[model samples]
Target: MTAALCLFLAAINIATLLAFWWDKDAARAARRRIPERNLLALALFGGTPAAFAARQMFRHKTRKQPFSTYLMVIAAAQAGGALGLALA
Candidate 1:
């Protein structure tokens, strides 16, 4: 990947991770939680690894229904794109 793409991915991943952390804290505080769609959107923006790591680390959304499905789809898409690029 190019330097710019790498940097963008890194930033998005970090942001996704922080968002998960923030949402966890919000839940614990009984505050308004971050929307599930927003988290999934972060994954769509190439934050799959960070989102997965955050889910595992925070013990959040591991068992959720559509959320897990969305993450899986995002991961699959990223892998497929990488494989396509490699074969090209």
Candidate 2:
């Protein structure tokens, strides 16, 4: 990936991570939670790396059944694309 692409990905990841953190805080306070769709949208938009890191670090949403499954699928797809690029 080019430097610009790397930076873009990094920004996405950071945004997603912070969003996750905010959601966690919101959950604790019984506030309006960030919608799952929004989180998945961020992941699909190339934030999977940061999303996974945030999930692991915050221990948030790790136990959510279908959400975990969806995240796995996103991660798999991203990894596959990266591998294809490397092999090309």
lDDT of each: 0.95, 0.93
Off by over 4 Å in 2: none
Q: Write the per-residue lDDT of candidate 2 for residues 1-88, one digit (tens) a residue.
A: 6899989988998999999999999999999999998999999999998888889999999999899999999889988998998999
Give the winner by lDDT: 1
TM-score per prediction, in order, is 0.96, 0.92
Candidate 1 colliding pairs: none
Which lDDT tens digits does candidate 1 get at residues 1-88?
7899999999999999999999999989999999999999999998999999999999989999989998998899999999999999
lDDT of 1: 0.95
Which candidate has the top score in TM-score? 1
